[model samples]
Target: MRAAELHGQRHVVVNVVDDVPPPKPDEVKIRIGAVALNHIDVWSWRGMAFAKRELPIILGAEAAGEVVDVGDAVEDLFRGDTVAIYGARTCGTCAPCREGRDNFCEGPQAMYGFHIDGFLRTHVNVPARIAVKAPKGLDVMAAACAPITFGTVEHMLFDNAGLKAGETVLVHAGGSGIGTAAIQLAKAVGATVITTVGTAEKAKKAAALGADHVINYREERVEGRVRKITGRRGVDVVFEHVGPATWEGSIMSLKRGGRLVTCGSTTGVAQSTNLYLLFQQQLRLIGSFGCRMQNMRDVMEKMAKGLVAPTIDTVIRLDEIEKGLARLEARDVFGKIVVAL
Candidate 1:
């Protein structure tokens, strides 16, 4: 078996590894087919890990695979089933996990591709409970994004922010992976989407992705445009991810009593907020992390229904991960990138 491992900061190697043994009790052995890249991969490559981790860690967070074997305890699943692996290793006994809020697990945090060996390998074993059956007819590349890209948007917009149809939303970095997913999902639900892009080219792409309005932040005032497009009412929800670079503008673009859901801080994190404005508007700033296992199921349902689709920018082999990571770090992508195993 082959695995892509991070040896050190900015160092990745594709090496042959021993084949994973058959599934243990309550586990499933999978042959990974496709892996999706996220900004977290870039962060790890740049040594921005927020917690303790060992080197030579396998490097892929979102992926879909075929079940080669299932443990004896597993009943509902069988060999040759295609499934999407949830990215995190949550303690199933925790209060939050019991309530279906797996993202808020109380036990030790072991995020795949971050805290432990991940799906970059050809074969791996994971708890059967964490795998969601990929919707029938969903290919490996599309299902690969279910764990992160679409799942995060589903959780942030519907679960956390409570975004409703006909309401307006401001999605920052509309060219990024999650950004593209946000645009399609928001639009699919009949929400008016206002998105910001870094370049003029991406602005056009955002428009094509059902964005009601596109702001080239590099050349225009995004806040001004959002206000004008909404007739000064501002947007009902702000889909924020870029950190300090657009933090103030994201706040300004929201209407009074509006909701803001954030999942990433690709830019620098430090930023100031207006305390008076925050209190005056009764605004809700929700900080969202990864999605629950159910969120992945919800997004996959949408994918199966053709209500939303993954916008893949490119596909790379396992050995070309460095180049893919470099492009992602430089913000030089139009949509999600996948690695085919």
Candidate 2:
């Protein structure tokens, strides 16, 4: 078997390793087929992890694989089933986990590709409880994206923000994987989408992805354009991720009582907010992390229904992990970069 591991900061290597054994009871052995790259992978490569972790950690968070074998206690799933592995090491006995809010697990921090060995390996044994079956006819590349790209947006827009049809949304970094997903999902439910891109190329791409309006933040005033497009009413929801560079604009672009859901801070994290507006306007600021297992399922179902699709920028081999991470860190990609095993 082969695995991509992070030896240290800016150090990624593809190593040949011993194959994983058969699944233990209540577990399933997956033959990983595809791994989707996210900003987390770039963070790990750059040693931006907030917690302590061992060196030589496997380096992937989102992936889909085939069930080569299942433990005796595994019931509903069988061998040969294609499934997406949840990107967290959550304790199932916790209250949050019991309620399907696995991201808020009360036990140890629930993170993959950071705290524990992740899905970049060719084979892995994961608890059957964490594996969600991919919908039939969904390709491995697309299914791999559901656990992170689509799931995060689904949780942010619908669950946290409570976005409704016909409302307008401002999606920051529209060329990003989750940003692209947000635009499509919001549009699918009839919400008007306004997005910001870093380049003219990405602006055109965002328009093609059903964004009602695209702002080239590098060349235009994002907040001014958003206000004009919304007729000064501002957007009902602000899909924010870029940190300081767009934080003020995101707040300024929202209407009174509007919601803002954030999942990442790819740029520098430090930012100050207007306390007066925050209280006076009754604005809601929500911080979301990873998605629940059920959110992954919902996004996968939507993918199966053609209501959403993964926008893959490129597919690289396991050894090209460093190159992929570099592209992501440089923000050179317009969509997801997948690694096929």
For candidate 1, write residues 1-341 as lDDT tens digits. Answer: 99999999999999998889889889999999999999988887887758489898999999999999999999978998899999998888989999999999999989999888899989999999898898788888889999999999999999999998889999999999999999999999899999988888898888998998899888899999899899999999999899999999999998999998999887888899997989999999999999999999999999999999999999999999999999999989999989999
TM-score to native of every candidate shown = 0.99, 0.99
Model 2 lDDT at residue 33: 97
Candidate 1 weakest lDDT stretch, 10 residues: 43-52
C-alpha lDDT (0 to 100) for residue 204 of candidate 2: 92
lDDT of every model, 2 decimals: 0.92, 0.91
Cα error, residue 8 of model 1, in Å, equals 0.5
Clashes of each: 0, 0
For every candidate in turn, the CA RMSD to the true structure comes to: 0.8, 0.8
Stretches of model 2 off by over 4 angstroms after superposition: none
TM-score of 2: 0.99
Q: After the best TM-score superposition of candidate 2, give how far the Cα of residue 61 lies from its true spot, in angstroms.
A: 0.4
What local lDDT does model 2 show for residue 176? 90
Residue pairs with backbone atoms closer than 3 Å in model 2 (clashes): none
What is residue 186's positional error in candidate 1, in angstroms?
0.4
Model 1 ranges off by over 4 Å: none
Q: How much is 41 displaced in model 1, in angstroms?
A: 0.5
